[model samples]
Target: MMEKKLALVGNPNIGKTSLFNQLTGLNQKVANFSGVTIERKSGTFSAGNQMYDLVDLPGTYSLIPKSKDEEIVARQILEESQRPDAVLVVCDASNPERNLLLFSQVADLKIPVLVALNMVDVAEERGILLDTQSLEKWLGCPVVAINARTGKGLNELKAAIEKAKIPDLQIFNPQAVFSDNSTAEIHDFAHWLSLQSGQEYQHTESETAKTDIKSLQQARETVYRYKKIKEGMAAHHIVQSRERGNEFSFDRWALHPVWGYLLMLGILIVVFEAIFKFSALPMDWIELAFGHGIALLEQALPDGILKRLLLEGILAGIQGIVIFIPQIAVLFFLIGLMEESGYMSRVMVLTDMLMKKMGLSGKAVIPLVSGVACAVPAIMSTRSMAGSRERLIAIFVTPLMSCSARLPVFTLLIGMLVPARAAFGPLSLQGLSLFGLYLTGLLGAIATAMVLNRLMPEKGRSTFVIELPPYQYPLWKNIWISVYQKSMSFVLEAGKVILAISILLWFLAGFGPGEQMETAYNQSLETSLASGMQRAEAEQIALSRRLESSYAGLAGKWVEPVLKPLGFDWKIGVALLTSFAAREVFVGTMSVLYASGSEGETEMLKTRMLQARNPDSGSPVFTGPVVLSLLVFYIFAMQCMSTLAVSYRETQSWKWPLLQLFYMSGLAYALSAMVFQLSS
Candidate 1:
């Protein structure tokens, strides 16, 4: 009845996680590595009569680790607490040498090992003949070829796992595992090792035998002498085989500097169009439910402060945020799909040269994609960038990606006011505006990275190394689970903050600081001109005066002068500023602000927005200039508190999050001001 633990270990992009997911299904869970914030994923399933626990470990090239992630994997191997009962060593059959380099290291570790030869289909397509039996004979392990994408050979792999036995461990082959200087050195050492007898390494229920220190040192020396020769042989084989007779389906053409960029842009446009078209229905449904709730709340209660707070403030805030869920979910789904399907690495591959110009590795692509959701996770995703400097640049620039949180604010402004017009022969002007906003985020991020390259001292070779995983159809279950999890997390975490802000804004705007509002209301009633008309005007004036005297209103007025050119008055300036905590807050704040002193029939939310006026100028607000300005602001602004919190955690510094805040704010202000000025 003992619980058996198994680990799926492999090089990055090997689809090890996909196999793990296929096996575990809905039984999976995520946790932080024992002491580190880096996450570890695990799951359980019943295979045969036993309950099996599967752990997906961090990937590494070899146990002799370099970066923090590699160190974590190596440490887990050494530590008793994380010891797995058996290890599934995953490899790509098409590129066996690189995978074998990792496999050879794992084989020496002396654990219960099973070799998963992934991408066998690709190997066949490329005309590479893999003799699994010969490989098994050479490595002294069970070799199971698999296509994780199609569930092919999964049963064989599982059966192998169920019946596996750990072999007597081999000593580390330093010549093969580490750096080498000459081929002569390798041959001499291989002869020397052939002359000496290897001890039979053993493991017990409790302990693995200590590796011989003397032999290990000798192996290291031999490897240092011969590794260069081995690497050259591997490269030569790859080239001669591919060039002469066998041509791989994958090509260098995919990474060509000019064509690759144009391809990436075209793909990006297609993705955006898909996102917009797909998310429409869900967005409409969300908007309708939210609108219904607000109406129901208003109808259920008598006119009072509590009713007003609930109807105008809290309900409005909820409506502002809920509409974004579908869009954000779809965006995350598309990103996750790209990553899983392996197109993401191609982007990283293609962009590596460009990244050098911006002082980063193409590996920064991870964070760049993750930034679509929130900048925090995006920044943390830079852990794979291989250097602190590159990672830092990725962190600093990632916030400029205009995360999904900005969708609500942009959607509200664009959809409500921006009329449909033609920007070109066929494209809608509104659609072009949307694309422009997204481009602003992208251009600003690249600009910031370029400027930082100039400001910061750069050293060390930031080589961009990545694997282009074999392409496959996007998995439905995995995609659905990812979309659901990402969208739900946003709703639950940011929703709580937004909901609180809405309630707080309601209280602040509904009631005044002192007895000033009461006195103001009484005076307006007493100074009547024409009885009925005077009473109505007095009530409207009192509401405005009360709001002006309120805490939120006062704060708005204080910042109004600085923000005026963005086509925002005191009220709008306040809403925009408060929305820094969340973009959705602007909608909620506007709803409540307009609801307070209305003279027209309040029906659709759009109608309410249409009637809002600038208090000082006494002119209609939320016009073309204001709507365009707002869209530009949201496009350029980093307005999500979740994104800031994430950036703080990922970069392990307030400096980064603060810099992101100021950078985004400055960009937003500059862009918004330009739009407003041009339109005016």
Candidate 2:
């Protein structure tokens, strides 16, 4: 049997997503909508003898869209090719007037829709008691009150869906939808809408033809719909007490001008510390497991290119990325907790003023905060911003924020530069460094936006509108699912890039043009023995010398002149070149290079980096200035190709992405050179 298709529709923050998660569990997959970057979430579940396919559409306030994301919701509902078999309108019981506005609009479309009145418990706690039977009678449809967080009424919702029929309701006539003087476009749209509702479209002429007739009609229509809705809901949804809840008390401080910013900063510090402290043990275990696996493979397999490829190329590179999964998962878990608990919305509200000062729309806060996970989705999220210039600015500056892909490289470098025992009071130096780097990225983004604001012509700005959800305990299952999905996404995406680059790097480092590698090995061995070095030490020296003469080394050497002033050697230069594919690939590339250069050594990448010596002066290669310079470089550089591609897609032009790449890379280089030169 064909599965019945249902779409979950509602305004933002109505527990619609929570209800979807409860229904789908871990069966859902996230993809892009047909021709847009907006995320599409869909899944399937069995309902007794029947199966159902559910899609969660983007949240919007009304059918008339103000942005691309909202446009998708409107199109999906009204277009014949994409309309769902039924729509489950998730409404907030506490805010019936606002939510019912959307519900009434959906009802007028004459499509089958069932009301999933969500957050009933919270509503009752606020002294708002909703009469489901009365609501059902008014709408001529079934209404099921559900608490999505606790799985209450889930079975009933599924049952209601299984038996749902076309709602015998049309709140308004399509023929009378438009004003007599409406434009041709408005008439055509209404005509199209009427066709879907099986209603006739009528045309009328008037002496005055307003160019903005659609907006005028929509405003009038909204008032009309709400008036009818209020009359229907007057007695059914009762508020027994007008008392303020704890939400008000909390918001007093959480949205305060002073305390709110401090509280938010303190929470961020704690989150960063937790990411470092909590992930240490798991990261160590992962490293140890990979180390042992590599060691076993080294001992069991004969010395050959295949063994080297398996151990040095594949295992080493993968370990570089896999060991960071715990940190990535922790980051996502803490972020998910903030979002699920409603604090994220508060953060957006708090930062709106500052964002405006930076010449960014208030909506840009979502993409900026989300950039911490990955810039691709963050760039894609700029579609929600109303103004074209604001959207472009958001897309351009978002990549400056340090994403999870940079986390591995940052952690690895920080561990080498700042000792684990170093601390400032209760905070570890490494954690502080991590937070400082993130702060730097944010500041860089702001600074760039300020400059862009001055350079670009003024486009009209949209007012910042946001709904603050009441504070609640996070749902652990949802947090866990989000963490798993995000961590796996990082692993799968980074793993592929690392594996391909590792193999290519290994092959290039293991071979050289003509007899250059053989001559370098022979000459290095002879000189080392002549200096009275032990045979084992001499052999290691020979291998290192051979690596320096290989094809990858030649390329690294070619770039060394340009990078020399930044305190980077040829090997570091090579890693820099490969990591353009992804920021995290810096770690994997270094891992592959070090493993190929160091024979008969089983030390971890960190140990090898710490012990590394400059070939010319024999001093530590990763000196204080060099490490600082490198960190500064990665912090500012547009190093990921995927981010560039996403930026192009979001802006629909190569000029923006290309300019972003050159600007970021140039800034990274100039800043790194100054840091190294001044520090040295």
Candidate 3:
């Protein structure tokens, strides 16, 4: 049997994607539309004996194309290439009047349509009722009320889809809608449609015949639909109740001028604290497991290059990948909760006024908040913004928002510099320090947005209109899925890069040219023998000397002079150079370098880092000042290659990403130098 295709369409924040997720579950995958970065989410589902392919189109308020994402939706609706067999229009039950405008347009296209009236539960809670049977009869189509979050009425909605059919009567006349418009483009489009549909067109010659004909027609249609819908509701006796009187009362405090900001700040502090305190146990377990695995490998394999590579290169890289899973998982879980409960939309509303001063639309808040998870998707989210200039600014500043990838680096450094005890009346000093780092990044992002707003040329004025979705209980299933998918993506995507670099670094640190390594080993052996050193001690000294003369050592020495002012040694210089590929690779690089030099120590990477010393001075390398300096550097540096590539792709130009790289790196260097100098 042939598979049927269906297109899912709705206005923004109407629960279209949630319904799609319910239908497709784990069978869905995301792809890009042709010649655009806009995402195309397609999936397959089986109903009875028949299979269906569903495409979740980007949400839009109307058929008008104003942005890249909206353009994709409009093109898919108008173009005939690979058109769906049917279209499912999702609408909010509480405000069906506002949402029916798109449905009216879709019905005019003369396609088979099925209406899924979603959020019925929310509508009922808000003391609103919809007469579904009367509405379905009035529209001459099936209307099934559904709650996408809890899978309520989903089966009935699917059954309606199975029986949906195209109606013979068209609700709105396309020719009449555009015949009297002054815009040449609209007139031309109307004439073409009339010719195709075999209808007559009535053209107007007056240019001032109310040039806003489109808006006027939309207003007329909206009034007409609402009037008909209200009559149907009255005939069916759908009444409003007073059970949920306080449903919208909470908005008074949430949207307040003063209390809103304080509430947001307190919420952020709690999120950061949860991330640090909850992930500690799991992170420790992962560290312990990897350390034991390395020890087991050492005991099983014979002493050779292969054994060294397995223990130091492969295991160390894996350790870097696994140790951060807990942090990444927790970050996404909290973000998902905020989104599912509708708190994120409130945040957008709260920041809208302040964001306008920075020349960004309130809609840019979604991408900026999402950047805390990962910058790639966050940058993509900006495509929904209505203006090009705002989108570009949002993309450019998002990377500074302290993503989950930075969590590992920040936690490592904070663990070294700050103690685990409470300070300032029962607050964890370490947790507060972490919170400060996150705040610093957020402030930097806002400051950068302001600067870019002034620098970038303006294309058009952007508006910030958004629907504040009502708060609801978050679904545990969705939260778990989000956390799992995001955490796995980080490990798989970054793990590949880390593993390859770790092997290369191991090779460089293990081998050297000519007899330099042999000469150093011989000199160290002679000195150890003259000092009456034991055989084990002498072997360790010789090994250290050999590592110092290896290729990695020479490369480190080459950059040592440049990094000396920042309190970094040759070994740190090497790690810094390798970390350009990714920020997390710094931990893996240090692990491999230190493990390769240590003969048979079973210490974890953190312990080894604490005990490390400068070969010449024999003083601790990771002093408080040095750790803080490194932390400052990572906080500001554009060290991730993947983020740079994504920025270039989104902007379609090298200038922005390259400028970002240099500006961030320069800032990192200057700040790190200052911190090192002041602290020392």
Candidate 4:
């Protein structure tokens, strides 16, 4: 049988994606539409004996195109070639009036439509009720009350979709409202249709006409639809109670000026603490297991380049990526919970005034908050911002917000520099220090936004528009899915880059030009024997000396002088260079570099890094000052090539991303230098 196509359409924050997830489960994938950067998420599912292809279109309030994302939605719904066999319009039951506007517009398309009244539980809690039968009769289609979070009413919704039919309802007619002066494209299309039907064109307009006839007509249509909706509600006795609700009471504090800021800070502290406390056991187990695996591999294989490559190059790099999975998973889990509970929208409301001072709107807070997870999608989230300048500023500075990629770097450095003991009652000092680093990144982004606001040209005033969604219980299923997806994405994306760099670095560190490596090894062996070192220790010393004469060592030496003032040595310089491919690669690079010349030590990367010394003075390389400096650097550096590429794609120009790269690199260097100098 031919697979039927279904489009999932709704306004922003209407639980549309939740419903899509419920229907598609694990059968979905994300891709970019042809010739466009906009994301297209499609999935396949079986309802009864028939299979259906579901496309989750971008959320938009109206058919009018204001941005690229919205334009895609308009084209997908309105163009005949792209239109689906049927559209499932998901509406928030808690606030049906505003949601019905989009539904009315989709209904006017005269396509097969089914309404999914989502968040019925929240509506009930808020003392608001909807009469599904009455609403279905008024709209001339099926209406299913669904709880997307819990999968309640899903069977009904699926049944309705299987038996869906085009509604014989026309909520509004353009021909009745548009006259001779209308300039909308809809009016032009109506006229063309009339001509094809043997009638004369009834509308004409000069290009200079100042009237927004389409908007005016839409406003009128909205009012008419509300009137009909209200009458149906009255007939069905659907009404709201007079008492104030729990969600309202909660928002009163969550959105307050002083308390809201305090609560947000507390939430951040709790998140960091949770990341440290919850992930500690699992992280230790992973590190220990990998260490044993490397030891077992070393014993099982004969001494050769292939054995060394397998143990130091591939396994070590993968271990670096996988050891941090627990922390990444926990961070995403908390973020997903906050988002599902509807608290994040309130955060946007609370941060608007402060964000305005930075020349960003409240809406910019969404991307900024999401930047903490990963900047690629965070920058994509900025497409919903109203103005180009505000969106650009948000994009340029968002990289400064410490992402999950930086989490491994930060955690490793903090473990090295800061004590693990508790600072207060139950909060670990290391956790507090980690939170401080995250706060530093946020402050850096805000400062950069302020500076850019003054320098960049603006075409128009920035607007802050947002809707406060009703509070609902977070679904553990959704949270787990989100955590799994994000954690896997980080591991898979960073793994590929780390593996390639590790192999290349292994070759560079293991081989060098001419007999320089041989001479260094022999001299080191003689010096170690003269110092009366053991045979095993002497061999390790000789191996280390040989690595110092290799290609990667030469490259690090070239940049050593510039990095000296920032408390970084040649080995760190090498890691910095390799990590530009990805920030998390710093850990992998260190793992491979430190493990390359070792004899049979089975210690983890952290222990190896701690034992590393400056060959000239024999002092520890990762001292407190150097560790702090490196931390500051990673927090500010534009070290991820993926972020730069995404920024370029988002802006559609090399100019912005290039400037961003130079600016961030300079900032990182300057800050690291200052921190090193002050601490030392």
Residue 665 in model 3: lDDT: 84
- In Å, residue 75's CA in model 2 sits off its true spot by 1.6
Backbone clashes in candidate 3 total 0
The 0-to-1 C-alpha lDDT of every candidate, in the order given, reads 0.69, 0.78, 0.75, 0.77
Against the true structure, what is each candidate's TM-score? 0.78, 0.86, 0.83, 0.83
Give candidate 2's error at residue 571 in angstroms: 3.5
Ranking by TM-score: 2, 4, 3, 1
| Residues 213-262 of candidate 2: C-alpha lDDT, one tens digit per residue | 54556666778777777776675554344445575568888888899999
**What are the RMSDs of all candidates, in order?**
8.6, 5.3, 5.6, 5.7
- Tens digits of per-residue lDDT, candidate 3, 1-680, equal 99998999998777787888899997877667888777688999977777899999988766545456766765676677967888899998877666776776677667788999998777886777767776777677788989998889998888888777664324454344445554344433223333332111222345357344444555555565556545655665544442443545667877788997788878866776676678889988887887787878879889987888888778876776677678767777887898887787788888888898788866787778667766755676676676667777888888888876677678778988888898888778987898799888888888988888888765444566677776667787778766776676566555666677767777787789998988998998999988999876677668766877999778888989988878988878877877766676676557555653332232366677888988789999999889988988888889876677778877889988999899888888898999999999
lDDT of model number 4: 0.77
RMSD of 4: 5.7
In terms of lDDT, the best-performing candidate is: 2
Q: CA shift at 203, candidate 3, in angstroms?
A: 30
The true-versus-predicted C-alpha distance at residue 561 of model 2, in Å, is 2.5
Model 4 lDDT tens row, 554-587: 8888899999999999889878987786687677
> Taking the tens digit of each residue's C-alpha lDDT, what string does model 1 give over 226-282?
353246334435323331223424445555577767888787767666666888899
- Residue 504 CA displacement from its true place in model 4, Å: 3.1
Name the regions of candidate 4 deviating beyond 4 angstroms. Answer: 35-38, 119-129, 175-180, 183-246, 300-307, 370-388, 403-437, 564-569, 582-631, 648-654, 674-680
The per-residue C-alpha lDDT of model 1 at residue 464 equals: 55
